[model samples]
Target: MQNIWSIFKRELRAYFDSPIAYVVITVFLLFTGWYFTTYFFLAGQADLRVILGIIPFAFLIITPAITMRLISEERKTGTMELLVTMPIHDSSIIVGKYLAAVALLIAMILPTLVYGITVAFLGDMDYGPAIGGYLGFLFIGAAYLAIGTLGSSLTENQVVAFIISLLIMAAFYLMDKILIFIPNSMVSIVEYLAIVYHFQNISRGVIDTRDLVYYLTLISLALFLATRAMAARRKR
Candidate 1:
Protein backbone atom coordinates (compact mmCIF):
# COMPACT_ATOMS: atom_id res chain seq x y z
CA MET A 1 0.00 0.00 0.00
CA GLN A 2 2.79 2.38 0.93
CA ASN A 3 4.68 1.60 -2.24
CA ILE A 4 1.57 2.17 -4.31
CA TRP A 5 1.02 5.51 -2.63
CA SER A 6 4.60 6.56 -3.25
CA ILE A 7 4.45 5.62 -6.91
CA PHE A 8 1.05 7.28 -7.25
CA LYS A 9 2.42 10.56 -5.91
CA ARG A 10 5.50 10.28 -8.10
CA GLU A 11 3.42 9.62 -11.20
CA LEU A 12 0.95 12.39 -10.42
CA ARG A 13 3.80 14.80 -9.78
CA ALA A 14 5.39 13.81 -13.08
CA TYR A 15 2.24 14.97 -14.84
CA PHE A 16 2.00 18.41 -13.19
CA ASP A 17 5.76 18.99 -13.01
CA SER A 18 5.82 19.25 -16.80
CA PRO A 19 3.68 21.17 -19.29
CA ILE A 20 1.86 18.03 -20.39
CA ALA A 21 -0.93 18.22 -17.81
CA TYR A 22 -1.49 21.92 -18.36
CA VAL A 23 -1.57 21.70 -22.13
CA VAL A 24 -3.83 18.66 -22.17
CA ILE A 25 -6.23 20.11 -19.60
CA THR A 26 -6.38 23.45 -21.37
CA VAL A 27 -7.10 21.88 -24.74
CA PHE A 28 -9.71 19.56 -23.27
CA LEU A 29 -11.52 22.35 -21.42
CA LEU A 30 -11.44 24.60 -24.47
CA PHE A 31 -12.90 21.90 -26.70
CA THR A 32 -15.65 20.94 -24.25
CA GLY A 33 -16.44 24.51 -23.28
CA TRP A 34 -16.87 25.55 -26.90
CA TYR A 35 -19.30 22.76 -27.61
CA PHE A 36 -21.24 23.19 -24.37
CA THR A 37 -21.74 26.90 -24.83
CA THR A 38 -22.76 26.52 -28.44
CA TYR A 39 -25.20 23.74 -27.75
CA PHE A 40 -26.68 25.31 -24.64
CA PHE A 41 -27.35 28.63 -26.40
CA LEU A 42 -28.61 27.20 -29.65
CA ALA A 43 -30.70 24.40 -28.26
CA GLY A 44 -31.73 26.29 -25.07
CA GLN A 45 -31.79 22.92 -23.39
CA ALA A 46 -31.47 22.67 -19.63
CA ASP A 47 -29.87 19.25 -19.93
CA LEU A 48 -26.18 18.41 -20.21
CA ARG A 49 -26.80 15.99 -23.04
CA VAL A 50 -24.61 17.88 -25.46
CA ILE A 51 -21.58 17.98 -23.18
CA LEU A 52 -22.08 14.39 -22.12
CA GLY A 53 -22.42 13.30 -25.72
CA ILE A 54 -19.22 15.05 -26.83
CA ILE A 55 -16.97 14.02 -23.92
CA PRO A 56 -16.39 10.46 -25.11
CA PHE A 57 -15.04 11.85 -28.38
CA ALA A 58 -12.80 14.23 -26.47
CA PHE A 59 -11.58 11.38 -24.27
CA LEU A 60 -10.57 9.31 -27.28
CA ILE A 61 -7.90 11.92 -28.05
CA ILE A 62 -7.06 13.28 -24.62
CA THR A 63 -6.79 9.99 -22.76
CA PRO A 64 -4.15 8.58 -25.08
CA ALA A 65 -2.12 11.76 -24.71
CA ILE A 66 -2.33 11.54 -20.92
CA THR A 67 -1.23 7.91 -20.67
CA MET A 68 1.08 7.57 -23.66
CA ARG A 69 4.23 8.20 -21.63
CA LEU A 70 3.43 6.37 -18.40
CA ILE A 71 5.43 3.22 -19.08
CA SER A 72 6.80 3.81 -22.56
CA GLU A 73 8.87 6.77 -21.42
CA GLU A 74 10.27 4.73 -18.54
CA ARG A 75 11.35 2.04 -20.98
CA LYS A 76 12.80 4.58 -23.40
CA THR A 77 14.83 6.22 -20.65
CA GLY A 78 15.87 2.83 -19.19
CA THR A 79 14.16 3.61 -15.86
CA MET A 80 11.71 0.74 -16.23
CA GLU A 81 14.45 -1.79 -15.61
CA LEU A 82 15.56 0.03 -12.50
CA LEU A 83 12.00 0.34 -11.22
CA VAL A 84 11.25 -3.32 -11.80
CA THR A 85 14.41 -4.32 -9.91
CA MET A 86 13.13 -2.56 -6.83
CA PRO A 87 11.25 -4.39 -4.08
CA ILE A 88 7.96 -2.91 -5.35
CA HIS A 89 5.41 -5.15 -7.03
CA ASP A 90 4.61 -4.62 -10.71
CA SER A 91 0.89 -4.41 -9.97
CA SER A 92 1.58 -1.65 -7.48
CA ILE A 93 3.48 0.33 -10.10
CA ILE A 94 0.74 -0.16 -12.66
CA VAL A 95 -2.07 0.76 -10.27
CA GLY A 96 -0.25 3.84 -9.06
CA LYS A 97 0.38 5.07 -12.59
CA TYR A 98 -3.17 4.21 -13.59
CA LEU A 99 -4.52 6.16 -10.62
CA ALA A 100 -2.47 9.21 -11.58
CA ALA A 101 -3.90 9.15 -15.09
CA VAL A 102 -7.35 8.85 -13.61
CA ALA A 103 -6.63 11.83 -11.39
CA LEU A 104 -5.80 13.89 -14.44
CA LEU A 105 -8.97 12.67 -16.10
CA ILE A 106 -10.98 13.86 -13.09
CA ALA A 107 -9.25 17.22 -13.25
CA MET A 108 -10.23 17.49 -16.90
CA ILE A 109 -13.81 16.68 -15.95
CA LEU A 110 -14.17 18.92 -12.86
CA PRO A 111 -14.22 22.18 -14.82
CA THR A 112 -17.14 20.97 -16.91
CA LEU A 113 -19.31 21.04 -13.82
CA VAL A 114 -19.53 24.76 -14.44
CA TYR A 115 -21.60 23.98 -17.49
CA GLY A 116 -24.17 22.19 -15.40
CA ILE A 117 -24.14 24.98 -12.81
CA THR A 118 -24.61 27.54 -15.55
CA VAL A 119 -27.57 25.65 -16.91
CA ALA A 120 -29.09 25.55 -13.47
CA PHE A 121 -28.93 29.34 -13.22
CA LEU A 122 -30.37 29.80 -16.73
CA GLY A 123 -33.34 27.50 -16.13
CA ASP A 124 -34.67 24.37 -14.55
CA MET A 125 -31.97 21.67 -14.50
CA ASP A 126 -32.42 18.04 -13.66
CA TYR A 127 -29.62 17.04 -11.35
CA GLY A 128 -30.26 13.32 -11.74
CA PRO A 129 -29.11 12.97 -15.33
CA ALA A 130 -26.31 15.47 -14.72
CA ILE A 131 -24.95 13.38 -11.87
CA GLY A 132 -25.32 10.23 -13.90
CA GLY A 133 -23.49 11.79 -16.85
CA TYR A 134 -20.47 12.69 -14.74
CA LEU A 135 -20.42 9.28 -13.10
CA GLY A 136 -20.56 7.63 -16.48
CA PHE A 137 -17.68 9.80 -17.66
CA LEU A 138 -15.49 8.64 -14.75
CA PHE A 139 -16.21 5.00 -15.45
CA ILE A 140 -15.49 5.32 -19.16
CA GLY A 141 -12.41 7.47 -18.59
CA ALA A 142 -10.92 5.01 -16.08
CA ALA A 143 -11.46 2.17 -18.54
CA TYR A 144 -9.72 4.12 -21.30
CA LEU A 145 -6.81 4.98 -19.02
CA ALA A 146 -6.32 1.32 -18.21
CA ILE A 147 -6.34 0.48 -21.89
CA GLY A 148 -3.87 3.30 -22.56
CA THR A 149 -1.59 1.95 -19.82
CA LEU A 150 -1.65 -1.41 -21.54
CA GLY A 151 -0.64 0.26 -24.78
CA SER A 152 2.14 2.16 -23.03
CA SER A 153 3.46 -1.02 -21.50
CA LEU A 154 3.74 -2.64 -24.92
CA THR A 155 6.25 -0.30 -26.56
CA GLU A 156 9.06 2.13 -25.82
CA ASN A 157 7.81 4.66 -28.38
CA GLN A 158 5.25 7.06 -26.98
CA VAL A 159 3.80 7.78 -30.42
CA VAL A 160 3.26 4.09 -31.05
CA ALA A 161 1.63 3.71 -27.65
CA PHE A 162 -0.69 6.62 -28.39
CA ILE A 163 -1.69 5.20 -31.75
CA ILE A 164 -2.26 1.72 -30.37
CA SER A 165 -4.50 2.99 -27.57
CA LEU A 166 -6.38 5.34 -29.89
CA LEU A 167 -7.03 2.62 -32.44
CA ILE A 168 -8.29 0.19 -29.82
CA MET A 169 -10.53 2.83 -28.24
CA ALA A 170 -11.84 3.94 -31.63
CA ALA A 171 -12.70 0.38 -32.49
CA PHE A 172 -14.66 -0.01 -29.24
CA TYR A 173 -16.32 3.37 -29.73
CA LEU A 174 -17.40 2.41 -33.23
CA MET A 175 -18.57 -1.05 -32.30
CA ASP A 176 -22.26 -0.33 -31.84
CA LYS A 177 -22.30 2.04 -34.77
CA ILE A 178 -21.08 -0.70 -37.08
CA LEU A 179 -23.72 -3.22 -36.05
CA ILE A 180 -25.32 -3.11 -39.47
CA PHE A 181 -22.29 -4.78 -40.95
CA ILE A 182 -22.38 -7.52 -38.33
CA PRO A 183 -24.55 -10.56 -38.66
CA ASN A 184 -27.77 -10.72 -36.61
CA SER A 185 -26.32 -13.54 -34.57
CA MET A 186 -23.41 -11.35 -33.47
CA VAL A 187 -25.25 -8.04 -33.04
CA SER A 188 -25.94 -8.47 -29.32
CA ILE A 189 -22.36 -9.50 -28.55
CA VAL A 190 -20.91 -6.63 -30.58
CA GLU A 191 -23.21 -4.06 -29.01
CA TYR A 192 -22.35 -5.37 -25.57
CA LEU A 193 -18.68 -4.84 -26.35
CA ALA A 194 -19.22 -1.21 -27.37
CA ILE A 195 -17.89 1.20 -24.76
CA VAL A 196 -20.37 3.84 -25.83
CA TYR A 197 -23.27 1.45 -25.38
CA HIS A 198 -22.48 0.95 -21.71
CA PHE A 199 -21.76 4.65 -21.27
CA GLN A 200 -25.10 5.59 -22.80
CA ASN A 201 -26.90 3.23 -20.48
CA ILE A 202 -25.37 4.92 -17.42
CA SER A 203 -25.71 8.48 -18.76
CA ARG A 204 -29.46 8.14 -18.94
CA GLY A 205 -29.74 8.37 -15.10
CA VAL A 206 -30.13 4.63 -14.96
CA ILE A 207 -27.10 2.86 -13.59
CA ASP A 208 -27.58 -0.75 -14.45
CA THR A 209 -25.52 -3.52 -12.90
CA ARG A 210 -24.65 -4.71 -16.37
CA ASP A 211 -23.07 -1.37 -17.32
CA LEU A 212 -21.12 -1.29 -14.06
CA VAL A 213 -19.95 -4.84 -14.63
CA TYR A 214 -18.85 -4.08 -18.17
CA TYR A 215 -16.70 -1.12 -17.13
CA LEU A 216 -15.17 -2.95 -14.16
CA THR A 217 -14.42 -5.90 -16.39
CA LEU A 218 -12.75 -3.77 -19.05
CA ILE A 219 -10.62 -1.86 -16.55
CA SER A 220 -9.52 -5.05 -14.82
CA LEU A 221 -8.70 -6.76 -18.09
CA ALA A 222 -6.63 -3.87 -19.40
CA LEU A 223 -4.73 -3.45 -16.15
CA PHE A 224 -4.11 -7.18 -15.94
CA LEU A 225 -2.65 -7.09 -19.46
CA ALA A 226 -0.45 -4.14 -18.50
CA THR A 227 0.85 -6.04 -15.49
CA ARG A 228 1.61 -9.04 -17.69
CA ALA A 229 3.49 -6.79 -20.11
CA MET A 230 5.54 -5.41 -17.24
CA ALA A 231 6.30 -8.92 -16.06
CA ALA A 232 7.46 -9.93 -19.54
CA ARG A 233 9.78 -6.93 -19.66
CA ARG A 234 11.21 -7.85 -16.28
CA LYS A 235 12.00 -11.36 -17.59
CA ARG A 236 13.94 -10.04 -20.60
Candidate 2:
Protein backbone atom coordinates (compact mmCIF):
# COMPACT_ATOMS: atom_id res chain seq x y z
CA MET A 1 0.00 0.00 0.00
CA GLN A 2 2.67 2.45 1.03
CA ASN A 3 4.82 1.37 -1.93
CA ILE A 4 1.98 2.10 -4.31
CA TRP A 5 1.45 5.51 -2.78
CA SER A 6 5.14 6.30 -3.10
CA ILE A 7 5.12 5.30 -6.75
CA PHE A 8 1.94 7.29 -7.31
CA LYS A 9 3.54 10.41 -5.80
CA ARG A 10 6.65 9.94 -7.90
CA GLU A 11 4.68 9.44 -11.09
CA LEU A 12 2.44 12.44 -10.40
CA ARG A 13 5.43 14.65 -9.64
CA ALA A 14 7.18 13.48 -12.80
CA TYR A 15 4.22 14.76 -14.80
CA PHE A 16 4.51 18.29 -13.38
CA ASP A 17 8.29 18.20 -13.54
CA SER A 18 8.04 18.11 -17.33
CA PRO A 19 6.39 20.60 -19.70
CA ILE A 20 4.20 17.93 -21.26
CA ALA A 21 1.61 18.17 -18.54
CA TYR A 22 1.20 21.90 -18.97
CA VAL A 23 1.04 21.72 -22.74
CA VAL A 24 -1.48 18.89 -22.85
CA ILE A 25 -3.73 20.45 -20.23
CA THR A 26 -3.60 23.86 -21.86
CA VAL A 27 -4.39 22.52 -25.32
CA PHE A 28 -7.20 20.30 -24.08
CA LEU A 29 -8.87 23.00 -22.03
CA LEU A 30 -8.54 25.62 -24.74
CA PHE A 31 -9.96 23.33 -27.42
CA THR A 32 -12.82 22.16 -25.26
CA GLY A 33 -13.58 25.69 -24.11
CA TRP A 34 -13.72 26.97 -27.66
CA TYR A 35 -15.99 24.16 -28.80
CA PHE A 36 -18.24 24.52 -25.77
CA THR A 37 -18.70 28.20 -26.38
CA THR A 38 -19.47 27.65 -30.03
CA TYR A 39 -21.99 24.92 -29.35
CA PHE A 40 -23.61 26.82 -26.50
CA PHE A 41 -24.23 29.89 -28.61
CA LEU A 42 -25.42 27.93 -31.61
CA ALA A 43 -27.85 25.81 -29.66
CA GLY A 44 -29.07 28.65 -27.47
CA GLN A 45 -30.00 26.13 -24.85
CA ALA A 46 -28.88 25.41 -21.31
CA ASP A 47 -28.40 21.79 -22.27
CA LEU A 48 -24.77 20.66 -22.47
CA ARG A 49 -25.48 17.70 -24.73
CA VAL A 50 -23.39 19.00 -27.60
CA ILE A 51 -20.38 19.78 -25.47
CA LEU A 52 -20.62 16.44 -23.70
CA GLY A 53 -20.93 14.65 -27.03
CA ILE A 54 -17.71 16.18 -28.28
CA ILE A 55 -15.71 15.47 -25.12
CA PRO A 56 -15.06 11.85 -26.07
CA PHE A 57 -13.57 12.85 -29.43
CA ALA A 58 -11.33 15.32 -27.62
CA PHE A 59 -10.27 12.55 -25.27
CA LEU A 60 -9.52 10.28 -28.22
CA ILE A 61 -6.53 12.51 -28.86
CA ILE A 62 -5.80 13.93 -25.41
CA THR A 63 -5.67 10.62 -23.58
CA PRO A 64 -3.00 9.09 -25.80
CA ALA A 65 -0.84 12.18 -25.47
CA ILE A 66 -1.13 12.12 -21.68
CA THR A 67 -0.38 8.42 -21.32
CA MET A 68 2.18 7.88 -24.07
CA ARG A 69 5.09 8.55 -21.73
CA LEU A 70 3.76 6.77 -18.67
CA ILE A 71 6.04 3.79 -19.05
CA SER A 72 7.67 4.16 -22.41
CA GLU A 73 9.94 7.00 -21.26
CA GLU A 74 11.10 4.99 -18.29
CA ARG A 75 12.08 2.10 -20.53
CA LYS A 76 13.72 4.35 -23.08
CA THR A 77 15.96 6.02 -20.46
CA GLY A 78 16.79 2.80 -18.54
CA THR A 79 15.00 3.96 -15.39
CA MET A 80 12.53 1.12 -15.68
CA GLU A 81 15.17 -1.33 -14.54
CA LEU A 82 15.77 0.70 -11.39
CA LEU A 83 12.07 0.99 -10.66
CA VAL A 84 11.47 -2.73 -11.24
CA THR A 85 14.26 -3.63 -8.82
CA MET A 86 12.48 -1.81 -5.99
CA PRO A 87 10.66 -3.79 -3.31
CA ILE A 88 7.23 -3.57 -4.92
CA HIS A 89 4.94 -5.75 -6.95
CA ASP A 90 4.71 -5.01 -10.65
CA SER A 91 0.98 -4.53 -10.12
CA SER A 92 1.68 -1.78 -7.59
CA ILE A 93 3.88 0.07 -10.01
CA ILE A 94 1.36 -0.24 -12.81
CA VAL A 95 -1.56 0.72 -10.61
CA GLY A 96 0.34 3.69 -9.22
CA LYS A 97 1.16 4.87 -12.71
CA TYR A 98 -2.44 4.31 -13.74
CA LEU A 99 -3.62 6.37 -10.77
CA ALA A 100 -1.30 9.19 -11.73
CA ALA A 101 -2.72 9.20 -15.25
CA VAL A 102 -6.24 9.25 -13.81
CA ALA A 103 -5.29 12.13 -11.51
CA LEU A 104 -4.05 14.13 -14.47
CA LEU A 105 -7.20 13.29 -16.36
CA ILE A 106 -9.30 14.49 -13.43
CA ALA A 107 -7.39 17.76 -13.49
CA MET A 108 -8.17 18.10 -17.18
CA ILE A 109 -11.84 17.46 -16.40
CA LEU A 110 -12.25 19.64 -13.29
CA PRO A 111 -12.30 22.92 -15.19
CA THR A 112 -15.29 21.79 -17.23
CA LEU A 113 -17.50 21.94 -14.18
CA VAL A 114 -17.79 25.65 -14.73
CA TYR A 115 -19.73 24.83 -17.91
CA GLY A 116 -22.36 23.06 -15.90
CA ILE A 117 -22.57 25.87 -13.37
CA THR A 118 -22.88 28.43 -16.11
CA VAL A 119 -25.59 26.46 -17.85
CA ALA A 120 -27.54 26.09 -14.63
CA PHE A 121 -27.55 29.82 -14.02
CA LEU A 122 -28.47 30.68 -17.60
CA GLY A 123 -31.54 28.50 -18.01
CA ASP A 124 -33.34 25.25 -17.16
CA MET A 125 -30.49 22.81 -17.26
CA ASP A 126 -31.03 19.15 -16.54
CA TYR A 127 -28.27 18.32 -14.11
CA GLY A 128 -28.88 14.58 -14.34
CA PRO A 129 -27.53 14.14 -17.86
CA ALA A 130 -24.59 16.40 -17.09
CA ILE A 131 -23.65 14.27 -14.12
CA GLY A 132 -24.08 11.13 -16.18
CA GLY A 133 -21.96 12.62 -18.94
CA TYR A 134 -19.10 13.28 -16.57
CA LEU A 135 -19.25 9.77 -15.20
CA GLY A 136 -19.36 8.34 -18.69
CA PHE A 137 -16.35 10.40 -19.68
CA LEU A 138 -14.36 9.13 -16.71
CA PHE A 139 -15.22 5.52 -17.48
CA ILE A 140 -14.38 5.85 -21.16
CA GLY A 141 -11.19 7.67 -20.34
CA ALA A 142 -10.18 4.96 -17.92
CA ALA A 143 -10.60 2.29 -20.56
CA TYR A 144 -8.68 4.37 -23.08
CA LEU A 145 -5.92 5.15 -20.59
CA ALA A 146 -5.54 1.50 -19.84
CA ILE A 147 -5.05 0.84 -23.55
CA GLY A 148 -2.51 3.65 -23.72
CA THR A 149 -0.68 2.14 -20.81
CA LEU A 150 -0.52 -1.14 -22.69
CA GLY A 151 0.88 0.67 -25.70
CA SER A 152 3.48 2.36 -23.52
CA SER A 153 4.49 -0.98 -22.11
CA LEU A 154 4.95 -2.40 -25.59
CA THR A 155 7.49 0.17 -26.76
CA GLU A 156 10.36 2.26 -25.44
CA ASN A 157 9.96 5.12 -27.89
CA GLN A 158 7.34 7.63 -26.79
CA VAL A 159 6.38 8.52 -30.34
CA VAL A 160 5.78 4.87 -31.13
CA ALA A 161 3.79 4.55 -27.94
CA PHE A 162 1.66 7.53 -28.88
CA ILE A 163 0.99 6.19 -32.34
CA ILE A 164 0.13 2.74 -31.10
CA SER A 165 -2.24 4.13 -28.53
CA LEU A 166 -3.79 6.53 -31.00
CA LEU A 167 -4.36 3.81 -33.57
CA ILE A 168 -5.95 1.48 -31.04
CA MET A 169 -8.14 4.30 -29.73
CA ALA A 170 -9.19 5.26 -33.22
CA ALA A 171 -10.12 1.68 -33.97
CA PHE A 172 -12.26 1.53 -30.87
CA TYR A 173 -13.77 4.92 -31.60
CA LEU A 174 -14.89 3.70 -34.99
CA MET A 175 -15.88 0.22 -33.90
CA ASP A 176 -19.58 0.85 -34.42
CA LYS A 177 -19.10 2.05 -37.95
CA ILE A 178 -17.04 -0.98 -38.80
CA LEU A 179 -19.78 -3.24 -37.53
CA ILE A 180 -21.74 -2.65 -40.69
CA PHE A 181 -19.60 -5.13 -42.61
CA ILE A 182 -20.06 -7.90 -40.10
CA PRO A 183 -22.57 -10.73 -40.37
CA ASN A 184 -26.00 -10.08 -38.91
CA SER A 185 -25.44 -12.58 -36.13
CA MET A 186 -22.08 -11.10 -35.25
CA VAL A 187 -23.25 -7.51 -35.44
CA SER A 188 -24.88 -7.69 -32.05
CA ILE A 189 -21.78 -9.23 -30.57
CA VAL A 190 -19.53 -6.63 -32.15
CA GLU A 191 -21.77 -3.82 -30.98
CA TYR A 192 -21.74 -5.25 -27.49
CA LEU A 193 -17.94 -5.24 -27.55
CA ALA A 194 -17.70 -1.69 -28.85
CA ILE A 195 -16.63 0.91 -26.31
CA VAL A 196 -18.81 3.59 -27.85
CA TYR A 197 -21.92 1.50 -27.37
CA HIS A 198 -21.51 1.28 -23.62
CA PHE A 199 -20.33 4.86 -23.47
CA GLN A 200 -23.48 6.10 -25.16
CA ASN A 201 -25.59 3.97 -22.86
CA ILE A 202 -24.14 5.58 -19.75
CA SER A 203 -24.12 9.08 -21.26
CA ARG A 204 -27.90 9.07 -21.51
CA GLY A 205 -28.30 9.31 -17.70
CA VAL A 206 -28.97 5.60 -17.40
CA ILE A 207 -26.74 3.94 -14.84
CA ASP A 208 -26.97 0.44 -16.18
CA THR A 209 -24.88 -2.24 -14.53
CA ARG A 210 -23.95 -3.83 -17.85
CA ASP A 211 -22.43 -0.62 -19.11
CA LEU A 212 -20.35 -0.20 -15.95
CA VAL A 213 -19.33 -3.84 -16.18
CA TYR A 214 -18.08 -3.39 -19.73
CA TYR A 215 -15.76 -0.53 -18.79
CA LEU A 216 -14.52 -2.20 -15.61
CA THR A 217 -13.75 -5.33 -17.57
CA LEU A 218 -11.81 -3.44 -20.20
CA ILE A 219 -9.89 -1.49 -17.57
CA SER A 220 -8.98 -4.68 -15.75
CA LEU A 221 -7.94 -6.51 -18.92
CA ALA A 222 -5.77 -3.66 -20.16
CA LEU A 223 -4.06 -3.20 -16.79
CA PHE A 224 -3.51 -6.93 -16.52
CA LEU A 225 -1.86 -6.91 -19.94
CA ALA A 226 0.36 -3.99 -18.92
CA THR A 227 1.37 -5.74 -15.74
CA ARG A 228 2.22 -8.86 -17.70
CA ALA A 229 4.39 -6.82 -20.00
CA MET A 230 6.20 -5.32 -17.02
CA ALA A 231 6.72 -8.74 -15.52
CA ALA A 232 8.07 -10.04 -18.80
CA ARG A 233 10.73 -7.35 -18.70
CA ARG A 234 12.10 -8.84 -15.47
CA LYS A 235 12.60 -12.19 -17.18
CA ARG A 236 14.50 -10.74 -20.11
State the C-alpha lDDT per candidate. 0.93, 0.88
Candidate 2 wrong stretches, greater than 4 Å: none
Put down candidate 2 lDDT per residue, 1-236, tens digits, no spaces: 89889988998998899987898889988988888788678766666887777888999999989899999889889998899888889999898999899888988898888888988999778877888889998999999999999889888889999999999888888888788799999998888888888888888889999999999999899999999997886688
Cα lDDT of model 1 by residue, 91-129, tens digit: 999999999999999988998889999988987787888
Question: What's the TM for model 1?
Answer: 0.97
**lDDT of model number 2:** 0.88
| Candidate 2 positional error at 216, Å | 0.7
- Model 1 scores a C-alpha lDDT of 0.93
Best by TM-score: 1
Per-residue error for 197 in candidate 1, Å, reads 0.5
Query: Which ranges in model 1 have alpha carbons more than 4 Å from their true place?
Result: none
Alpha-carbon RMSD, each predicted model: 1.0, 1.3
Model 2 poorest 10 in a row by lDDT: 43-52
